[model samples]
Target: MSLTAVETLNREFLEIRCRILDLAAMLDRLERSDDTVADDPRLKRIHEAIDLLTKSASRNSSSDRAEQVQLTFSRPYDSAWLQNLKVRPR
Candidate 1:
């Protein structure tokens, strides 16, 4: 049987909150660091994923936040990738 909405929230809320706190701490560390990573693509992808998380459910019809966040960090598939990387198929 599926969990009721309240039960699901009760079970998952602390974990979710912890993750958010972790992300916030990481961002804070980055901001305080001497090195500049503001122009890095990875940082841009992180911002994109953050935006995805904050988007309203009504604005986004699909409920695949994990997939969306993952895609934000993924490169487009290239058929020649293995050849480019010089990896021989077994």
Candidate 2:
């Protein structure tokens, strides 16, 4: 017999999780390399989008998190400061 709705969803969830883990590992390797092509607009946008997505995911998860965290930031910052945002060269 074919899988039920729940089974299909569960399979997809696992697949997505595995893909995310693989992506994470690749990104980790890229982080160590100095040959990053920051000049590529597509790469730039992808990096920005992923950063936002990760922060959004973290914020949502943190809300229901058991261990409370009170993050403080300087002027012109809020919950966004709670995220580990990229630090551009100053």
Candidate 3:
């Protein structure tokens, strides 16, 4: 991919990660509140948005890291390098 494309994707990934964190904070606040607004349809939408953002952020992070690995290991693969390719479980 072009440098511009990689830059764009990196920015998007950061934005999505930030958004997911923000949504998680908002959900925590709502869950702690005693008011009816906490149980409103808008809150449900926010919850769903959080779930979508979490998945998107995870996929983007993986893709970004994979691209970096490809760039870093452009030469013929070695056994040690292949062993290091496994992503640690989250």
Candidate 4:
């Protein structure tokens, strides 16, 4: 890729990100409302989009963090067996 290619992509990428966030926030509000949105196809598609984005992000993450998963323990001491506990940049 060249500089011009990047320049062309930057605005589009930012716009897409903004739109996705806005959509997700709207869906979040709907999910929190009293109405039942679980069976909604639109809601399902939103969830799927988020999952796909998360997996893609994980793939691009630094080596210091887990590639595709985040782990948690039941109790504080239950995680003692773990060794690596590094934080990665957002």
The number of the candidate with the highest lDDT is 1
Off by over 4 Å in 1: 56-60
RMSD, candidate 3, Å: 15.0
5-32: candidate 2 lDDT, tens digit per residue:
6998787998878988997897788778
Q: What does candidate 2 score on TM?
A: 0.40
Sorted on TM-score, highest at the top, how do the candidates line up?
1, 4, 2, 3
Tens digits of per-residue lDDT, candidate 1, 14-48, equal 99999999999999999999998999988999998
lDDT of 4 by residue, 58-77 (tens): 78744433322232212244
All candidates' TM-scores?
0.89, 0.40, 0.38, 0.43
Lowest lDDT block of 10, candidate 2:
65-74
What's the CA error at residue 37 for candidate 4, in Å? 1.1
Q: What's model 2's lDDT at 31?
A: 74
**Error at 12, model 3, angstroms:** 1.9
Q: Show the lowest summed lDDT stretch of 10 residues, model 3.
A: 64-73
lDDT of each: 0.90, 0.62, 0.63, 0.62
Q: What is the lDDT of residue 16 in candidate 3?
A: 69
Better of 1 and 4 by lDDT: 1
